[model samples]
Target: MAGVLTGVVGALLTLLLHGAQHVVFGAGGHSFAQEVRLASPPRRLIGMTVAGAVIGLGWWQLRVRMRVIRVRDALGDPPVRLPLRSTTLDAIAQIIAVGAGASLGREGAPRQVAAAVAEVLCARLGLDDRHRRLLLGAAAGAGLAAVYNAPVAGVLFAAEVVLGTLDYIAVCAAALMSCIAVVVAWPVVGRDAVYHLGAHATAPNVWVWVVLAGPVCTVAGIGFNRLMEAARRGGPSRAIHLLPLRITAAMAAVGLVAMTLPGVTGNGKSVLEALVGRGGLPAGVLFALLVAKPLLTAACLRGGLTGGLITPSMATGGALGALVALGLGHDQGGLSMVVCAMVGAAAMLATTQHAPIMAGAFMLEVSQAPPTLWLPVALSVAGAWATPRLATGLKQL
Candidate 1:
């Protein structure tokens, strides 16, 4: 009874907090997009200056918790402190940075928030480790659900990535919390929808596309996937350490890239939306953005930017897929490619998180598009095929 009650309370708190998170996150995304696109010449320069400073400061402060904070190890590892305080502060700060035009996503930030909340509560209550772990998973599910309004995704995320497997009790609690979160986020983000719809088809028309989708996307993206592995496993490689100084030199080189192609520096939703029909810049500009966005994202992470790799993958996959679509089928091709990018987001994320069903489910819930759930399932599972091989660092299950 007590455990159930605690779980219920934790779930409710997560639901409520998620309401605030959604409104703030949506407003942040909306405002950040506008801030990026406005006519001001110095806007990006200012954003980067602020982002660089914030990242430097945030990382330094994070160092204090270094003794206690094992970011890479904490993937499925035990909690080191109370969950609520640390995760909530992290979430709030991350949302602020992302909303202000820093190229980070809200997904991982909320995981830390919800985990901290559950951990602290479980500790105070003297719950056993297993029960506390379950509670922690429930809280994570709720926060993720709130962000994307995807209940199944939330539950599966907790099970696959957080808990390493599903527990019947955990699933029930996650479901309840996820329901509360989706309901809470609806009014704040306005339940209209997040994804733009194109003409709905029953399935992919080409056997070739179907066969190619997995291989092409997997390959087109596998190098970046390797980059993520490199990023996670990187820092100082002794003899090879200063050699990466070449990357820093690459960063200073971007100062020139910025002179003409500034849009590549931050999150690329503005560019993604532009591909939808605005055509503010020519397709060539969009192509330049495709090249510049990924390189810069890698550069930023390599260059000391803070945050997850979700949005950067989304920017590249979406725009590149759109460009592919334009070449093959124009708008339809572009739209298909855009959908491909969305699938890539789920796929690449699945690779990183090692949670294909979870990632696929997340795609379904967060996207307003109808039941193309099969695509995500295929992409996610395929993307995760190498998880066992690639499961170094945070992905080691």
Candidate 2:
């Protein structure tokens, strides 16, 4: 029953986000908000600046009035409870941010909302702390599963990342909840795989190149994390939170970037999808986007906009992978290029999130890649994850 309810809510949330995007951005179902061109340059600028103000205001409210309870804070031994008001506000704020073309993902919002709902239910049922945490993790994973239509990856993510343990009961519950969520969401969101790699077959000869791409992805992923941490540092410092001035400056910066490079505006999903379909973009544009996206994403994160980094990370990784493939003289539509993309994307996601298993599983599920490519993907993910620590001796990632 809990699974069903969570699943239904997750589905509804996905639909609501899509509907919001359609109305706001006229994306018409592009998860990445591709249709920024649909709106005039002036309009995009106005919309994004307004969104920044709204996001800033919302964050200010939560920081001031509500005792914000993060899932990470609550995941520890002493389970912390979530406040419904704060969670709902956060979720709604995320919706508005993403709908207005903020460079972030909606995935985290659904998970947070679902986990908050689960926390409330568990409290009402008088569940023990351990059970509460487990249920919360499961519900959160269900939301992710529903969003991507990947139940197994959802279960693994909850077990591996959320709960930080592989308890059998928790795993089973997460699995069941993920299945329920995806099943419920299937009708509305449809059952198509997220990325369609056409006529792919693994090329063992080029597997070495895929392995080499691992280090590239690792550097990119680690670079992004470091930038984000730096940005996040300013969040609590009063000097950085200079009311409208700071927010206005940040939004204006984003507006300037949007006016010049609209591709960097949203989560970069459409951009990634375009690259996937077209194989490789012109080298200049590809490199330019690669450089521009992370900086913009860092700014957004630092500027008080709330959304997930998963999609953005994936987009960046995909672009990097395509660029690498192009450099290697491989056709974009070749199996080797696809493998590079998968490995690159998985590598970045795993290293950044510290969940190689979840990243690999998610890449596999979302791309629906042939099983033959799994070994290369796994190797690339493992190498990418380890390279950062080796290079910087940074165990924090």
- Go through the candidates in order and give each one's C-alpha lDDT: 0.53, 0.74
Which RMSD values do the candidates have, in order? Answer: 6.7, 3.2
Candidate 1 deviant stretches above 4 angstroms = 1-31, 65-79, 82-87, 199-207, 232-268, 271-283, 332-338, 372-397
Per-residue CA lDDT of candidate 1, range 250-309, in tens? 334443465466566445555544543233345687688767776665655554434555
Between which residue pairs do clashes occur in model 2? none
TM-score of 2: 0.89
Tens-place lDDT per residue, model 2, 1-397, is 5677767766776676666556555664345435676666776777677767766776776667777677777767455678777987878777666766777777888788888888889878999888888898998888888888888899988998888889899999999999988888888767887776655555655676677767877777878889888877664345534544555456657666777566776667666666655454666666777888888777776766657888788878877876777777777556566666677778888877888889999988877767776887889888877776677776545
The candidate scoring highest on lDDT is 2
Q: Please, what is the TM-score per model?
A: 0.73, 0.89
What's the CA RMSD of model 2 in angstroms? 3.2
Colliding pairs, model 1? 83-116, 83-117, 84-116, 84-117, 87-113, 325-333, 325-334
lDDT of 2 at 130: 81
